[model samples]
Target: MSAFPIDYAAVFQALPGGVLLLTPQLVIADANEALLWRAGRERHELIGRPLFDVFPDNPDDPDASGMRNLRASLERVVATGVRDSMALQRYDVEAPGRPGTFEERYWSPVNTPVLDADGRVRLIVHRVEEVTEIVRAGAGDHPVDRVRMEAELYTRAQDLQEVNERLRLAQVREREVVLALQEAMLPAPVPVGHHRAAVRYRPAVGALNVCGDWYDLADLPGDRMAVAVGDVVGHGLAAACVMGQLRSALSAAARVADGPARALEVLGIYARSVDGAESTTAVQAVIDWSTHTLSYSSAGHPPPALLHPDGTVELLDGATDPPLGARPEHVDRPEAQVAFADDAVLVLYTDGLIERRLEDIDVGLARLAEALTRHRGADAETLADALLADLLPPGGATDDAALVIIRL
Candidate 1:
């Protein structure tokens, strides 16, 4: 009785609950240090192991059935020395590479009847408590059920990235108002004089940000010269104000026409007298250049590809017209006449170069005539950037596109 100054390991390490001793053949003689640090193991891995081989119960995980109903209520108080109680439960412990952490348990059991002085019963006295902080304080009243599912997935990804950044800033302000209304509708790029020199342009991927396709090179007053490409129906700012009224009534009907099918019949009676709030669809051509002939027309669009000088390739597809505000019963065809001999190459485009709709427009027109006959040895801005990298098949084009190239 001289060593009975008992501090029994500070009363079983200040028993908040979770003490053990299950011997009567269930092994695990003693454990405390908070059940050996919640079984992450220590007291020599909890003395002789057993208690169902160190708390094994997860049989198909019903959250390990509250430690398997507290080992069936401590086997009914070790078969009779009776004393039991249980309450706090809830456990979802899955700690293997973490990520799931839930716990709350409260248990009880006590039984005693061992004595070599002439009595026998052995051991049992297990208790545990770790109410996982009262189930995480009742999960703070379910914070609006988890903030209404993270505010509807952050408001549908912040409204689809704000409508794709407002359609890429309205296609960069409609290509800066289609280059300030195509520089107030054709003012200079010279050649309205230099006999036999014309240029029409609208390549830079147009109002997809190139501004509604456009181009013209005139030298009218002497041995005429006129070339064109146009498209204006839908796309920002009413297609840049109907592409400056069909490029200023096509430079005032190619300076009072005499070719390109009477300057597209004077721009189709100037597009059936506009005012349906602007609309367009054009393609004109005229190059006499001292009898090196070539006249054209096509009030609807997309059919102009001629590269001769021995690499033979011509396509000004037969008759087509029905685009400008589409009515007044339109019709202005025939523009495939060619005699552009010496090193010729004329290509006008505006259905974004041989339209692309996943093959078959005759296979995107035989893949734009085999990529303009395999870049016919480039150089016209590398054959218009290798025919837009061989008709965009590597991610480019959800819709809008444009291009135009001509070299003679």
Candidate 2:
């Protein structure tokens, strides 16, 4: 056999993988240019340095499990001795200004003999393949797979954003529509030169945008002021249309309403032909403010609650009948009342104002009264807001609410 001499450095440099040969005491015995470049260190700084101290064994990456993980990987490699692939296994290598970035590196003790012409393991060879990109789903060219996956992800994100934008736009439009219709139903607060007043209406949680909740205020001749609130039975465009008709008819009825009962009879008869049970309930009052008396009527409506100056409240119960939509014969006329106080508050509202499935109507009414009691110090607007907050049940409501607070 012919004897052969070799150049160890040239041989190692010729290899493709990043290679590092470490001495027993942890000094970098030798390292290929590829290893030095990947480690981002100069050749002069590479050798004569401890593996942990020189390489930095990236311990900052939690997935790499830190230094404990780095040491564990070394332990397995030393125990096994045989080189193994790290395609599945993960570890970390130090990076400048970073604790450690993850990577997959293989370790194998070099087969070169320590004793001359004798077979003995002397140096440990570390082969590192940066598997960070692979673990992060950025590894390998994977042209067809990666390109298609990236395109799909981008498309999905765009679609979700577009859908969310559309949803937001639709909500805004819905609110605008509700506000518009509500405005149309209410008469500009007719400034009763001699009377001070306030009105408020709020929609329920599940109530469709713009349903039939309505209110009206008018200064009729004969020193009488007519006020009314009613709910139609439906929602959306149809409900709005019918509500407009009801509001017109109610306003006209107030002209000759005389008393709460007669005007309601006019309404009941009109309702039978227009929208019997299909319509909703309401309470109307014609106030002869000068006399300090109110002529009010109820049609399947909760009675009006009176809040006194002393913070006490009372409800007016009088001739009442089923909602107009039920049947012409089932309707009742309005009632005249002299029971109202000289310096008191009167509140009228739709069913949505105090109706909740979580509590009975009486409880809701009691809550309303309690709310009124708490608002003794509040002006009309503040009192109205407090009433809404207090009367609205836990969770939410499913209908529209309207309120008119009149202080006499």
Candidate 3:
């Protein structure tokens, strides 16, 4: 029998504790029933509103710090993609139907991040439990009892701080492991005969953005060389492992296959069996220095740029097809060849180098072609650095990019 479908929305509303779903911008996307009831608000009153605007600190209380602390905790979660357990807080909620009147409230709150496959925080789960009665009960009539309670609260806060530190350390260690794996997979590019080649791989900037962008270079017999760059669909360890498998498979196929197109066909067949390898985009090219020709093929990736001696740029886009594992049946991939001048340069790269949010891809391709023309006289290594500086933002790229430059 098939399993029953679960209604996630209903389960969210039925949760025992008050919960708010917030975007990274702190806008309230949703609030569970318990939260709406506790705040004395309707669903429409809170949804689509900025969190702080809906529950601002009471203006009458000069010492109020609830909003400030909560904002800090939420921001930390967004930055680190880690959970934050806040200390017990004294937050006053405005009394419903009574303007300018506020009631003293205490809360135990925790903010957790909902991370994407790339390890970036997509949403925040703000869970809170009202503890007004508990705090009031602990407030004794005698000064000695009150002092003891305050001491206990202080200890609890210290414990939470220690836990937060441990979590931060663990996150740091995980990032190190991912970076190490990426470095192990992508080795430095070596020269092919007299042709100088330079490669660059930049992971997306963020805690969880270490992705599966990769480049491989292999020297073939008869003064020929093959280079390929690919991007896996997701990010983190799973994507990296898939990237390693695909890169190795393509590299091996390049040695035995007759052309770039055939190498990609073999890689595509292997990708179908690998988990998390669907819709992977890659471009492979074989440069024959004796013939001064570059044969290339694409699996739904950005075209490689061929810069002529006179600075005229040619985009090798004539032989493009759907990404790997995109189709159920096997089909022969197309191949194209272009004769190059002795001093010409060839560039192969992933889309992150040129793609921007809400912009046309042609615009980015045009920009790249112009940059290549402007710096056509530079050596391969210098040209690679110049292109990255020109194309990437100062803060860094939003997606992983792998670039290969070869002087023909």
Most lDDT-accurate candidate: 3
Q: Write the per-residue lDDT of candidate 3 for residues 181-201, one digit (tens) a residue.
A: 989988677666666689998
Candidate 1 structure quality by residue, lDDT tens digits, 88-202: 4443444433434333332223333232211123577676666555545554568785456434433543454456458557766767776676666654545455443333343
Highest-scoring model, TM-score: 3
TM values, all candidates: 0.28, 0.56, 0.70
**Ten residues in a row with the worst lDDT in model 3?**
113-122
RMSD, each candidate, Å? 27.2, 24.6, 7.8
Model 3 residue 192 CA deviation (Å) reads 2.2
Whichever of 1 and 3 has more TM-score, that candidate is 3
Full-model lDDT for every candidate? 0.60, 0.65, 0.88
Residue 178 of model 2 has an lDDT of: 66
The lowest-lDDT stretch of 10 consecutive residues in candidate 1 is 112-121
* TM-score for candidate 2, residues paired by index: 0.56
Q: Write the per-residue lDDT of candidate 2 for residues 1-408, one digit (tens) a residue.
A: 337888877989877767887654445788898777666777777787887777554454433333343344344334323232322233345554454454444222222212111112346676665544543475336877765754554455445445644754675576678668768767775566567567877665432345678887777786678788888887665676677777788888878866667877777777666743264677888788667788788877887888888898777667566777666355345475855666688888887777664456897788788888888767776777778777664444456788887777
